[model samples]
Target: MYTIFHAVFGYFFMLLAVRVLVRRPGGQLTPFEFVIIFLIGGIAILSTIGHDPSVTNCTCAVIAVGMVHRFVAMARTRWRRLGRWMDGLPLVLLRDGQWQLDAMEGMRIEPDDVMAAAREQGLTSFSDVKYAVVERTGSISIIKR
Candidate 1:
């Protein structure tokens, strides 16, 4: 029963970390967002199935980060400028049917990634994507030209 208790709590709370902390924040990914996921995964594993680090320790850390995430989300929404700092606004990968190779390189996304996204949308040529945005959530958002 005790084992089940820890496992359930950690599992559900991890969902909160993903939902409220990550998606609800901005539906986008920034470097900070990546870090939060990496840390949460490490803590979740140790707490869910390991004993060296107690479940309470993991829960506490998760709660703390969750609170901060929520605060940032609220702040970003309330203040437009702050939100931009906390959550990166979308970047244009293509404009007027032209690829922005420099932006793609800076964002560390290869051309193939864009092509794959395009193919998913039935776009066989570059001109089909009017604007491709690499969202703050580290996901790609494509708008067909």
Candidate 2:
């Protein structure tokens, strides 16, 4: 029972934490980011299993977490509003060679990141960018003029 409870709570806690802490949409995870994620997984396991090292307890906890994940994914697909609430809507960082400073600031996106996306898209400068949006997945999408 304790393992099940922890599994459910940990799932939601990590969900919220990720939404708050991670801003880069689809950006490659830095080594530090990767370590943090790995540590979180380890902590979640410890919390969910507690002192119980039994296979049954661990198995039940894993199942509970997996089920909740599947339910959330299904709910997001079925309900657009829920999906938007969970994942957030994409924000326009640049449009028509003009920077949307407020939006960029809100998302903590740096100019270099936007410029990198533009360069990847074969744009020499923001002047050649029709649109640059921070996608929900945390990666920049650049549309060239």
Candidate 3:
């Protein structure tokens, strides 16, 4: 019973921590961010399971965490606002050949990042790009003119 509560609390705590700390997508995570993620996961597991080495406790903890995750997923689907808040909305970083400075600053994105995405799309210059968006997944998307 206490294992279930601990697992639930740990799950939400990790979710909130990751949402606040990680801005880039998994594919783009730097080594530093990867270390942070691993450390957080380790801490969450230790805190959730405590000193219990019993198979029963481990099984219960796993099930509790899974159920909590499933519930959150379902709730997000049913609530648009919750989904938006948890996952975030797509942000425009560039528009009509101009940088959206405010949006870029808020997202901690620089022009170089946008240009790198553009270069990935075979664009050599911003003048050839019409728009750049930071997708909900933290991927930069470039629309070329």
Candidate 4:
């Protein structure tokens, strides 16, 4: 009986909890977006495994983290200061139609990786790459110079 009760409440509240907490409410998630996802997963596990100490405790923790995440996300969008910290600064991978060999070595990314991303955008030759950048999203974007 207790197990069933917790299951129903857990499922229901988690649904309502996520709905009320996230921004862009019902939308897709990106790779970096998975960080918050894992965070909520931990909260869910805590709320369900030992719901005895009160599900309220886990619920409150989830609400608090969600609020903080929402607040940070909003501030990041409004202010460059916050955005840069969370998303990281962009890096240049190519310059003047040439690969920045030193930069690539430093970042530990290889030529093949750059070529792969470039190929996805119709670039088959190195000379065609005007600028290749590792954007804050962890994706490489290339410009044909």
In candidate 1, which residue pairs clash? 28-136, 28-137, 29-136, 29-137, 130-145
- Output the number of the TM-score-best candidate: 3
Per-residue C-alpha lDDT of model 4 across residues 79-134, encoded as one tens digit per residue: 99867755556679898866777768765567886788889998888888988887
Clashing residue pairs found in predicted model 2:
24-138, 25-137, 25-138, 25-139, 26-137, 26-138, 26-139
Model 2: residues with Cα > 4 Å off, grouped in runs:
none
| Candidate 4 residue pairs in backbone clash | none
Q: For model 3, where is the 10-residue window of minimal lDDT? A: 21-30
Candidate that would win on lDDT: 3
Q: Which TM-score value belongs to model 2? A: 0.92
CA lDDT scores, all candidates in order: 0.69, 0.87, 0.88, 0.66
Ranking by lDDT: 3, 2, 1, 4
Ranking by TM-score: 3, 2, 4, 1
Clashes of each: 5, 7, 0, 0
CA deviation > 4 Å runs, candidate 1: 1-40, 43-59
Stronger candidate by lDDT (3 vs 4): 3
Model 3, range 82-126, lDDT digits (tens) per residue?
998888888999999778888999988889989999999999999
Candidate 1 residue-wise lDDT, 1-145, digit = tens: 3444555676657755665464323444568777888898788766655664566666655565566567767877899997665455677777776778887767767778778778989989777888888787657777887
TM-score per prediction, in order, is 0.57, 0.92, 0.93, 0.58
* TM-score, predicted candidate 4 vs. hidden true structure: 0.58
